[model samples]
Target: MQIRKAFRYKLMPKGEHIRKMKQFCGYARFIFNRALAYQKAQYESDNTVKFSYTRLANLLPEWKHEFE
Candidate 1:
Protein backbone atom coordinates (compact mmCIF):
# COMPACT_ATOMS: atom_id res chain seq x y z
CA MET A 1 0.00 0.00 0.00
CA GLN A 2 1.08 3.56 -0.68
CA ILE A 3 -0.07 6.91 0.59
CA ARG A 4 0.15 10.13 -1.33
CA LYS A 5 -0.38 13.66 -0.10
CA ALA A 6 -0.81 16.93 -1.89
CA PHE A 7 -0.36 20.44 -0.59
CA ARG A 8 -1.09 23.80 -2.14
CA TYR A 9 0.40 27.14 -1.17
CA LYS A 10 -0.03 30.64 -2.54
CA LEU A 11 2.80 33.00 -3.24
CA MET A 12 2.96 36.45 -1.70
CA PRO A 13 5.58 38.22 -3.72
CA LYS A 14 7.31 41.32 -2.43
CA GLY A 15 6.95 44.64 -4.28
CA GLU A 16 10.25 44.30 -6.10
CA HIS A 17 9.58 40.63 -6.84
CA ILE A 18 6.17 41.51 -8.24
CA ARG A 19 7.65 44.17 -10.51
CA LYS A 20 10.35 41.81 -11.78
CA MET A 21 7.79 39.09 -12.33
CA LYS A 22 5.63 41.44 -14.40
CA GLN A 23 8.62 42.52 -16.46
CA PHE A 24 9.70 38.94 -17.11
CA CYS A 25 6.16 37.90 -18.02
CA GLY A 26 5.82 40.81 -20.43
CA TYR A 27 9.13 40.01 -22.10
CA ALA A 28 8.19 36.35 -22.42
CA ARG A 29 4.85 37.25 -23.95
CA PHE A 30 6.51 39.50 -26.50
CA ILE A 31 8.95 36.78 -27.57
CA PHE A 32 6.24 34.14 -27.74
CA ASN A 33 3.83 36.31 -29.77
CA ARG A 34 6.55 37.51 -32.08
CA ALA A 35 7.73 33.98 -32.84
CA LEU A 36 4.14 32.87 -33.36
CA ALA A 37 3.47 35.76 -35.74
CA TYR A 38 6.59 35.02 -37.74
CA GLN A 39 5.81 31.34 -37.98
CA LYS A 40 2.22 32.11 -38.96
CA ALA A 41 3.22 34.57 -41.67
CA GLN A 42 5.74 32.15 -43.12
CA TYR A 43 3.11 29.43 -43.23
CA GLU A 44 0.61 31.77 -44.85
CA SER A 45 3.08 32.91 -47.50
CA ASP A 46 4.09 29.34 -48.35
CA ASN A 47 1.93 26.37 -47.44
CA THR A 48 4.94 24.05 -47.38
CA VAL A 49 6.65 25.83 -44.50
CA LYS A 50 8.20 23.40 -42.04
CA PHE A 51 8.80 24.07 -38.37
CA SER A 52 12.50 24.17 -37.51
CA TYR A 53 13.79 24.54 -33.99
CA THR A 54 17.27 25.37 -35.22
CA ARG A 55 15.95 28.17 -37.39
CA LEU A 56 13.87 29.56 -34.57
CA ALA A 57 16.81 29.40 -32.19
CA ASN A 58 18.90 31.25 -34.75
CA LEU A 59 16.35 34.05 -34.76
CA LEU A 60 16.61 34.63 -31.02
CA PRO A 61 19.64 36.91 -31.20
CA GLU A 62 18.00 39.08 -33.84
CA TRP A 63 14.81 39.30 -31.87
CA LYS A 64 16.69 40.23 -28.70
CA HIS A 65 18.55 43.01 -30.49
CA GLU A 66 15.33 44.25 -32.08
CA PHE A 67 13.57 44.19 -28.73
CA GLU A 68 16.35 46.20 -27.14
Candidate 2:
Protein backbone atom coordinates (compact mmCIF):
# COMPACT_ATOMS: atom_id res chain seq x y z
CA MET A 1 0.00 0.00 0.00
CA GLN A 2 1.12 3.57 -0.71
CA ILE A 3 0.46 6.65 1.37
CA ARG A 4 -0.75 9.96 0.01
CA LYS A 5 0.53 13.32 1.23
CA ALA A 6 -2.18 15.51 -0.26
CA PHE A 7 -5.49 16.96 0.70
CA ARG A 8 -8.64 18.17 -1.07
CA TYR A 9 -11.20 20.79 -0.20
CA LYS A 10 -14.88 21.21 -1.00
CA LEU A 11 -16.17 24.75 -0.37
CA MET A 12 -19.54 24.28 -1.96
CA PRO A 13 -22.22 26.53 -0.53
CA LYS A 14 -25.79 27.28 -1.56
CA GLY A 15 -26.49 30.39 -3.64
CA GLU A 16 -28.29 32.20 -0.84
CA HIS A 17 -25.59 31.18 1.60
CA ILE A 18 -22.92 32.56 -0.72
CA ARG A 19 -24.72 35.85 -1.02
CA LYS A 20 -25.07 36.15 2.72
CA MET A 21 -21.43 35.23 3.15
CA LYS A 22 -20.38 38.00 0.78
CA GLN A 23 -22.40 40.52 2.74
CA PHE A 24 -20.89 39.34 6.00
CA CYS A 25 -17.41 39.50 4.53
CA GLY A 26 -17.96 43.07 3.36
CA TYR A 27 -19.28 44.08 6.76
CA ALA A 28 -16.42 42.42 8.56
CA ARG A 29 -13.87 44.17 6.35
CA PHE A 30 -15.54 47.53 6.93
CA ILE A 31 -15.56 47.02 10.69
CA PHE A 32 -11.92 45.96 10.72
CA ASN A 33 -10.80 49.05 8.79
CA ARG A 34 -12.88 51.37 10.90
CA ALA A 35 -11.43 49.92 14.07
CA LEU A 36 -7.93 50.42 12.74
CA ALA A 37 -8.65 54.03 11.89
CA TYR A 38 -10.05 54.67 15.34
CA GLN A 39 -7.06 53.01 16.90
CA LYS A 40 -4.75 55.22 14.88
CA ALA A 41 -6.61 58.37 15.91
CA GLN A 42 -5.60 57.86 19.51
CA TYR A 43 -2.02 58.72 18.57
CA GLU A 44 -2.31 60.64 15.28
CA SER A 45 -5.04 62.90 13.96
CA ASP A 46 -4.09 64.91 10.81
CA ASN A 47 -4.95 61.85 8.73
CA THR A 48 -1.31 61.99 7.64
CA VAL A 49 0.87 58.89 7.57
CA LYS A 50 3.43 58.16 10.26
CA PHE A 51 5.05 55.17 11.93
CA SER A 52 2.96 53.86 14.85
CA TYR A 53 4.68 50.77 16.22
CA THR A 54 3.77 50.83 19.90
CA ARG A 55 0.13 51.55 19.21
CA LEU A 56 -0.11 48.66 16.74
CA ALA A 57 1.51 46.15 19.09
CA ASN A 58 -0.76 47.23 21.93
CA LEU A 59 -3.86 46.79 19.84
CA LEU A 60 -2.93 43.52 18.17
CA PRO A 61 -4.51 41.29 20.79
CA GLU A 62 -7.72 43.33 20.97
CA TRP A 63 -8.01 43.20 17.18
CA LYS A 64 -7.59 39.43 17.19
CA HIS A 65 -10.49 39.13 19.62
CA GLU A 66 -12.70 41.25 17.39
CA PHE A 67 -12.06 38.87 14.48
CA GLU A 68 -12.73 35.85 16.62
Which number leads on TM-score? 1
- Kindly report which residue stretches of model 1 are placed more than 4 angstroms away from their true locations once superposed: none
Q: Give one digit per residue, the lDDT tens place, for model 1 in 1-68.
A: 99999999999999999999999999889888988999999999999999898988899999878867
- Candidate 1 RMSD to the real structure: 1.4
Q: Which pairs clash in model 2?
A: none
User: Which lDDT value does model 2 have at 41?
Assistant: 78
Each candidate's TM vs. the true structure? 0.83, 0.50
Candidate 2 whole-model C-alpha lDDT, 0 to 1: 0.75
Backbone clash count, each prediction separately: 0, 0
Candidate 2, residue 67: lDDT: 68
Candidate 2 lDDT over residue span 1-57, tens digit each: 998798889999999999999999997787668667776775476655564667556
lDDT for 14 (candidate 1): 96
